[model samples]
Target: MQETVLFVDDEKSYLAYTTSIFENKGLRILTASSAMEALEIIDQEHVSVVVSDNEMPGMRGLELLAKIKELSPHTVKIMMTGSADLSTALAAINSGEVFRFVVKPWKKSEMLRAVKDGIRRHRILQSLAREDEYILHSLAQTIELKDASTRGHCDRVATLALKIAAELHISVDRQREIKYGSWLHDCGKIGVPEAILNAERALTPKEFDVIKKHTIWGCDVVRKANLSKTVQDIVLYHHERWDGKGYPCGLKGEDTPLEAQIVAVADVCDALTMDRPYRKGLCRDEFLRTIVEMQGTNLAPHLVDTLLQILERD
Candidate 1:
């Protein structure tokens, strides 16, 4: 699909001339005469770039740019103004957060170059977002490898969570969140000492307390990294229980984010069914029975049902 660009200006001649310059670029161009009209177009179209004149009738260029940033943060913003004042340029850069600024009486070539650069910057931001997600997944795998008994555990939980999310009919974006949450659910273990983590025997009170710190530690790690609120919530609350008996925050019932709760159930199921260094894996029937028993007490009841259905289909 051709990328859509929204150009906002109150001047009819300027709008016509500017629109004509990019008409042959194969872009879906939308023009608005006012800031309010521009906002309406943005709401109605998938605008990838927003170009606004610095001086408009109702709303100044900077004001319209700020509103565009608020409405569509991912869209690249460009400010075009007749004023060449230093303060105006600085305010446009700082307040509007424009990707490019073009002065009025712009050469067609310069304006075109600015638009091209804005598109390039937008692509770079998207690539960076993907890289961030890749790095987070790589770290999750590293966390899983820290414990021999839990090797590949995170991957399995993530897979199961995605399946459960599908059964629950979540949006594709939400399913991605569930997958990331499941993979990083145990990331807090990075802060725990290896001895306690790999201990053959049961943990003492102090060791158990230290182990429990992983949830909070993971939450802090993700928070500091500035991950999306949904992913951060999952990492923080994956250890919480339905009966209010689990983990750092003790968030019970619906207080726990639904994606986190789903991950918790998947993680427990995988842990029970997979063989560990210290114990053999449970038989399928026994595993199913155990999870069924924990439904309302330990796991979210709806998620538990979905999980069993997933297993049945498999």
Candidate 2:
């Protein structure tokens, strides 16, 4: 396959120098002296990797990377800067805008290696996106096998979530995202020890902390899988509460992604109504009562109402 890398820098000399270095490397190289020019090229070509300079005039590399993320999420972004700083690096990484950070005066071999690795990562992402639906469904089921008490939990959640999404009248694409996210929401639990998951006794604070880390672990699991953003959001934030008392990020109210908020409601309801080693499943009446009590606190208020309406009709 032909791999095309786009290098964006305001300095014409830097662009020319890098172009010369990689000219005979058997890879297609495209250069842009500004962010706008780079975007134009991107619109016309299928770029594999984008290596951008952070301190460009008009549009900073970080800003351009953000736009590229929105424009072509599959394109791998790499940030290269002469004036490297911790803040910039953290921002790029936390936002998931850049795949790699390279200093401006990087070694020729090291830069080449990073670009090659970025291309490989991009290819992996594309391949995962093309994975058959059954394969992904199987992976979700395999994740559930790690916890015996929760067999079919993901499937139930996906069904319930899809219902809620439809009731909410969201787009079909969003509905699909909700379903995919529900199925893979607890995939991070694979990182938790079986003993901890199956413990009938109360969990110690340390043990609970370990369990909470499952969301992060789950995010890491799907990070390389190239799942859609909505799926990722649900997997990472499904445990977050609406009133700001949740784990990981403690996002409050509408600050949490709507998809995550919807999944949180479905997840808790499913868990409450399903059998567990620690407790028996809540009956329908008990489940409804418990959810009503939890509304506006642990779960989204509107979603609670929506779920109630759904159950009432069912």
Candidate 3:
């Protein structure tokens, strides 16, 4: 489908002129006479760009731009106004989050150029978001590979967390976040020394302290890398316990992000059921019983029940 652009202006002549210009360029254009009408059009259309005149009767152009930012944050916004005053430009920049500002009596070529640049910037933002997610997943895998015993642990935990998310009927976007969070849940371990990580025996007090630093380290790494806040929180707090006795920050109970808590239960269940260098894997019955016994104490009660139901059906 062709990318759609929405042009909003109280002036019918200007709307007609700009719509014709963009249409000739093989772009799909939707027009609205007022900000309210424009919002309605936006709700019904997949608008990639919004060009709005600043001097409308009901809602001024700057106010319309602010509303657009709230309604469709990803849509590129361009403000067109007769006034080139400092205040108008500042409002467009600060409040409207305008991608470009066009003065009234804009040359057709100038208008076209601004639209093209807005589209390019939107695409660049999208590409950067994808690249950020890729880097996060790569870092997660690297941390998983640090210990031979947990080579596929991240993958398994992510898969299990996604299943639980489905059972809970989470939104598709939230489920995706949970899945990514699960993959990178243990990334803080990258900060722990290899000697402490790979040690076969129970960890010494100092070594354990070093291991615990991984959670803080992981949060710092993500914060520095500018990962999404939700993913960063999950990585930092996945080690927290339901009873409040666990981990680098010792966050407990409902203080943990729900996604992190779900992953924590899945992570522990998988770790217990799968073979580890220190011990043989538990039998299926024992594994199920162990989780059931810990419900409401170690695991979130609802998630524990969901996990057990999954295992039962399988």
* Local distance difference test values of all predictions, in order: 0.82, 0.86, 0.80
RMSD in Å for all candidates? 6.2, 9.2, 6.0
Q: Which pairs clash in the backbone of model 3?
A: none
**Prediction 3 TM-score vs. true:** 0.67
- The prediction achieving the highest lDDT against the true structure is 2
Candidate scoring better on TM-score of 1 and 2: 1
**lDDT per residue as tens, model 1, 162-235:** 98887876655567667777878889999999888888777899999998888889888887886656777888
> How does residue 143 of candidate 3 score in lDDT?
81
User: In model 3, how large is the Cα lDDT of residue 207?
Assistant: 87
| Model 3 agreement with the true structure over 182-215: per-residue lDDT tens digits | 8887888877887777777788998888877777
Each model's TM-score, in the order given? 0.67, 0.61, 0.67
Point out where model 3 deviates above 4 Å: 1-122
